[model samples]
Target: MMSILGLLELNFSFQLVSFPAVILKRLTFHPDDCFEVRTPNLASLGQEEPWTPNTLSLRLDLSDPSDPNVSISLYFDPGTRPLGLLPGSKILLHNVEHKISKRKNVYCRFINTSVLTVISFPPSLQKRITTDETSFTRLYLRDIRGSVQGMQQAVCSITRISRLTLRWNCIWCGKLFTKGRCAARQEGFCSSDCGRFGASASVVVDDGTAESLALVEAQQVAVMLGLTAAEWKVLKDEVWMRGELEYSYNQQFHDPVADPLWNVVAALCCKASSFRRFNLSFCLKKQLHHQDVSEKTFQLGEMRYATQLLSSPVLFVKNITPSDWKALVSHWQHLHEAEQSTH
Candidate 1:
């Protein structure tokens, strides 16, 4: 049975009990077998109201001097999804409807009539938050472009694809390769020579608070080229394989308009009021604006600069080509040509 300290009569059908107030710290659903949420009962590890076995209630920081009341937890039934409830959201609930379970623990029911409002994260309250590793109370998107200057880590979503991505430049001359043999190398033309076309492109993703270009690397290009080469070889060898008008590599590579799958991918990556955790390093420095942004945006002076961004991938990618593979092939080809000249 619920050992309530006391209960007071209310105008509503149910009585209102004066329980300690609390700020929400977390609301997660972990599958039990397939992360199934168990029914809340008295026999649960801690005889707490509004918590099932799968809720796994642990990450809370309750030292707010603004409202110094004891912390309490709340639970919504499986089907009931509170629209705006999030961690750090303050709620005032006059919830009180007692029911006794088989395990003899008193369960407090927070029905729909309870007064709950989700408050936006208080930006000024950031000062009260410590630099604790496990603390989620601090950090916002606006401050992220500055706060994450050191080796701070935060979760973010990969939101939009950047057209400026996938630029292929000559490894030697380091110029945009549109056409013409690269002066730096003999075989591959300058990346600029390829024009503004590529299989993989850059993207902008954000953790709820801060946005950055999701980390890009040279290998992403190699993945695209490798896929193209594989598709080309397959087409050359196979007699019965159906011919594809567009290259197979094109399936994964497309503009935001041409391919809609990336839009779906972006949505899947975002969790409402939740983010994927990543260990990351960040450095803040002003960089000269890109040609695309420079032309589109107005500038005050010739030396216009904005924050340049880069990040590493938490997602694993395949190693389509090893670093030394190209160097070895180029060396052997040059040596073979030298021998032929001597002959």
Candidate 2:
């Protein structure tokens, strides 16, 4: 406990590394198949020394008695973390054989203490969970070996607590991560802002509006880039909230409504182009790498002709010859005038 408080006060941090060694000793209670561990010798606490035990404890003790007032206790299950110990390391131990007879079970007596400076995961070739892969927790275990000699209880005494807080961390990013904001919110990103890259990504969205918008925009962008419905669907739900479109439309009707008007204008514009006769060959010869020609890539072939007129997009100014814009407006005006005459 003294050691822990001192560590907290000093803001001590250690570099953890894994190395292969041996468990010199271990004591298992055959009835429950659990083990108890303690410092095996005094000479083993050297820097970079590995920890070995005849019996490994389910808990570890890390209190110091040099000063008596401030101390701390931490409890952990076996296989909770990879096992390695360097000089200055602490361990919490529990004696399961000496539980008190009461409505509640209480642990007592000191087994041993290890003088490891650090603990860390052991190296393995198996790839850990990464963000690019499917999001889920996969099980893993690492073999660790280190040597440390624990001191006697008279040197430092620590009382065990009923429970300890365990941190849940991101499997990929290795930071504190959690779920549940309010009762109303659904789970995914820790918060809505994180979903949108807005703030620090800590607030949760109770309503699904933000999520729905993101999904729709991803789908629309997929369409504009010539993606199939199935292909778009595969990536639809994987976008951020801020990237969503500002408007909403019925998915069933959107395709039918937007296609015709765009097609007519695009066809007229393309026909007016010097390259109209080469349209089929031009499309076929378009650089596939540069072309958004997926099976469902947006069918905006007509608009392609019109966009070609715009230049200096940075200036928001049309780069086409004045005659081209004038012709387009005049053509629209003529259509309007003809419709009025018919009416």
lDDT of 1 by residue, 1-343 (tens): 1112222112223343324333434434542333323343212213233222223422222223244443333444433233223334443334434444475543355554433333343222232222323333433333543224333433333334343233334445555443343334455543333222223334453433334554334434333223356743442233112111122212454577864444433332232211222323333333222231311222223633233233322222222222231332233334445556787
TM-score of each model, paired residue for residue: 0.29, 0.17
Model 1 segments more than 4 A misplaced:
1-142, 145-151, 175-202, 210-215, 219-277, 287-343
For model 2, residues 1-343, the per-residue Cα lDDT tens digits are 2233434332333211111122222222222445443443223222211322213343433334344344432333332122332213332321212233264433222322211222222122112222221222222111110111121000000011111112333344333333412212244533322221111101010010010001112222232223467844433232121122111111221253645432332232222221110000000111112222223122222422111211100001111111222232233344445556787
Q: Which whole-number lDDT from 0 to 100 does residue 19 have in model 1?
A: 46
TM-score of 2: 0.17
